[model samples]
Target: MWTYLIHGEPTPGVARLLEGVGRALEARGFRYSPEAEAPNLVLNAITEENPKPYRRRAQATFVASVLELPRFPEEPIKELYPYLVRALSNVLLAYVPGEGAAFLTLELGHYREKEGEGFYERVAERLMPIACSRLVIDNIFVPDLEPELWEGDELTESMYRAGRKLKEWDLLPAPFPIEEILPPEDLRHVKRLYGIGGLSYGNLSVRKDERRFWMSASGVDKANLKVIGRDILMVKDYDPEKNAILLSVPPHVEPRRVSVDAIEHWMIYREHPGVGAILHVHAWMEGVPATPFNYPCGTYELAQAVAEKVREAPDPTRAVVGLKNHGLTITGRSLDEILERIEGKLVRTVPMS
Candidate 1:
């Protein structure tokens, strides 16, 4: 059994948020105990100003301070907590204006035995959300394309159809219109694609030009990517000298880093210009050809290997390359084309090994 404790004074709205979170956990068999027992989680909602120098700050004013418990019992619980935090934060942000900030802290009893102060602090940092605001932009900015150049084309129509198909197939949580989410001036150079997931994993992209593109901020939920000004980051330039990619974000939007797999996507686009859109899903493609090398996700090695495999494929436009032990990366001339290929290959019923 597990328990929870609340510290600090929270407003009526925040109180309700805590209660709702408790109910969510309780439904999963967690119990509440006033006693400070082992295997319990504590929530500290600090309404007043915190004086601590090390307190984490929110990217925007919507959240004042946020802390995550450094410890958990095990795998499932560890995974579930981040989702809960993300859900709660999303709900809170809806009510909070740009000027308002809500402070929250999560403490775990399991780590109490750890002696070093730095140890717990390090743990808390790791558990915290990737960003205070769901939408993040980098510091760079690029010139926008002329409006006349942004008129709908065959590729745009294909992208729109593909977005709808992804939503229909339940790969995207909701319909995301590309035009609405992106600036009109940026539309001509941009072609977008999205995949759904909870707080931890998802993929989205904006092909800026033939050679460059942008991707979703790391760890953002796909369902929350309804609009563009906030949820995505534009890759301005890649510095091979530093092995770094430069990003351009919207004004007033703080720089949120790109996904770990950004390199992989970059590699694909650089190697295959015919591949206009890419869709990565966390499912197996049993019979599809995969990379011979088993590199870990997000590594440059993996990116290079996946791109090499994709390049070798006979049909670059309709290629499906597996990441050895990981998921599948599908590419096509357009999003609609990718969807058509995926629809044919997807197993409607449970898959047997």
Candidate 2:
């Protein structure tokens, strides 16, 4: 069942906005659920007076902060980033009574919902995917990584060199500067809640065999990938029961989690064995068929969507597909080949919707 809840006491303006939103959602089969029921989506209504997270019991529960702002700033990304990060919401809905609506995603995707035909319906359509999507970031660490597999292998070296190449091309942008952005108390809360120092970007992976692959570590400097089971980890498979990616790492080493897009790469690699390498960047190119929506990373919906697009491409092994409001995911026969083909073609700035 589709369940949603509007958290907290809504002010006059917020109540008015949510009334329409609730009706639209009910038309689409979503019922108003109480927090005790663990609703699929929670619209945390925050005003200039009070702004805080609802701190729901389930981390998997998607939270979209409905902020009733007096007026939006000229530069929303700069202004909204802090709110979204501090509140730990997946998306931020900035609303003005009769003005308009704008939102920013965890990926820093900022979009505005223009008032027009099906305006409320349009907002519902965009929020539904996010509400339905569940993050697949749980990792079950195994202490049986073979010493021979840690580093010094040909595939591992290739990954390191490729990571450095990405840095040369200025693709591996730094992780969100959470340390510099948030204050101590709020920072501690966010850190404790999400277990994330900062949001990382861009990942590279190479097929190891029919079943396994090696991928970049999350939240690390891509150019300086040195340690195995730390910088680069082997993705053995996905554990459906655990709802986590299975990683094999050295018993003595503390391993960092694999990139959140591990499942997306895993799906593509499993579907098309010919795809020897995969690269995802916060950059874009011309004429690539893109996914209709930007499903958050680490979700099965995103993996399925990207896989379907890759299957439809002329050549699944060497296809370039765009992730709407995000970036590009390119498949190639090798990392070198992908880098070569994308040379002089990638637009440094990813155009947001």
Candidate 3:
């Protein structure tokens, strides 16, 4: 997970793309400024045309900016926040542990043309739902020196209560069946699941049977030397209707309502089209620098940033980095492939200060 800013010259194609964009700008009775800050408008113009090459160039330019630019000034973390925020969402999705599933959904309207709507309101509308959905109960008042009730055991219970209430209201996402399957006795695959230590629990995804996929059950730690079938949990006939609703599981024990983040995962499948499996794990140490700053991970901006990255990446398989404090999401054509990416990222990632 490298982070920085990009600047200087961009791909020659980008310059050509910008030239075309500049023409479109003139057509719209707008003009580019001679100032250096004009690149932002030029880039926006390129997006308007929506050409493949131009978009590719834009992505390359963005990556280059990220790879090359200096650190963001402290005052503007809110303004110049990088796609890193969404990357954190991706990470947290991966490591969201438990028996249920988690996902993410982008507010398609976020990218829609809003004419003359206020930017702040548009941003709020697009991002706030994704953020607030996780809050469970709302509108409660809090006293100074006292935290909101959403803390610890009380908070956990409240979350469950909220989940139960959401389920009653039919507000939760449509669930995909989470079935527990006995994986074939392939020691290699077993080793892959338990590669980081603990037990040998493997994942296998089935797309031909879109209604169902297999997962190792809760309580069956992948590090255990032997994992039995009884330990596996099955979520059957999930998303049978293929609706937009997403499902999630809490991080605690037993069967609970699926996670609100499940919509994000559902969106991944929708956006990527062929993505079949995902592996998530909460990896520590990725947030060494922010630890001192007390900067939290997994916020709305992070989710949006990562969702855009996932949508833009040539292959979701390559989008491994998530929020620093959260975890990882690895998607691929099969469970084995997804798991490999998850393990590889964890094994190779060296923390930054």
Best candidate according to lDDT: 2
* lDDT (C-alpha) at residue 311 in model 1: 86
Model 2 CA deviation exceeding 4 Å by range:
48-50, 179-195
Report the lDDT tens digits of candidate 2 across residue range 1-353. 78998887777887877888888988988998774557888888886556676776675678888888888779987888777776668888888777768988887678888766676787787888898888788777898778887664787788788888888988887788877766787677765655556677899998888998889888888887778888898899998888889988988789888998999998998889899999999899988899988788878999889999999999999999999888999999988899999999999777776
Best by TM-score: 2
TM-score of 2: 0.93
Give the Cα-based TM-score of candidate 3 against the true structure: 0.31
Model 3 error, position 324 (Å)? 2.8
Report the CA-based lDDT of candidate 2 relative to the real structure: 0.84
Candidate numbers sorted by lDDT from highest down: 2, 1, 3
lDDT of 3 by residue, 1-353 (tens): 11112133434433432344345444444444444321222232111112111111111111111111222233332222222222212101110111111112211000121213342233223222232222110111112111331122322332234334333433332322111221233323322422211122122222323342323332233232122122222223224243222222222323322222333444455566577655444342242222111111223234344456566566774455453323444467755454444442343232322
Q: Residues 1-353, candidate 1, lDDT per residue (tens digit)?
A: 54445544656755654565556556555565645433234555533233111111222212222233223324422433332233222111111321222222111001111323343233223222311112222233443423432332344344445545655666642222334433443333322111212233436454658876646555555545432334555565666655566665544444455665777788788777777777776555657777653343455666777787788889876688876534578877766567667785663221211
Q: Give the candidate order by descending TM-score.
A: 2, 1, 3
Residue 258, model 3: lDDT of 25
Model 1 misplaced regions, further than 4 Å: 1-164, 172-199, 347-353
TM-scores of all candidate predictions against the true structure: 0.47, 0.93, 0.31
